[model samples]
Target: MAGSFFRVACQDCENEQVVFGKAASEVNCAVCGTTIARPTGGDAEFTGSVVETVEAR
Candidate 1:
């Protein structure tokens, strides 16, 4: 709800974070703080035509 970012499923807490940018690539979970999949050139991952948001509140 702040800026354009990427959400990675926390391996523990299952929360999302805005760890993405034009140069920013790798991201850690906002809940668990675990390293998620490194996006290609800060690109967001998608599931077919829908973007996958593997995060939990």
Candidate 2:
């Protein structure tokens, strides 16, 4: 199984960003610098709303 990517909308600034499902580090919003995703042991925990799941090609 391969890791997936997601389009997340930031709650604070509404910045849309693509994040890795199995991110090894914390992901922050580009516009507002807010914490968007946190790295868990396996998958990342998204703090913002998930707009869509990006298909890996």
Best by TM-score: 2
Question: Per-residue lDDT of 1-57 in model 1, one digit per residue for the tens?
Answer: 323544445655656454443324555555565666455554544211213433322
Q: Which stretches of candidate 1 lie over 4 Å from their true place?
A: 1-7, 21-23, 45-57
- Residue-wise C-alpha lDDT for candidate 2, range 1-57, written one tens digit per residue: 689899999999898999998889999999989999999989999999999999663
The TM-score obtained by model 2 is 0.92
| Cα lDDT over the full model 1 | 0.45
Clash-forming residue pairs, model 2: none
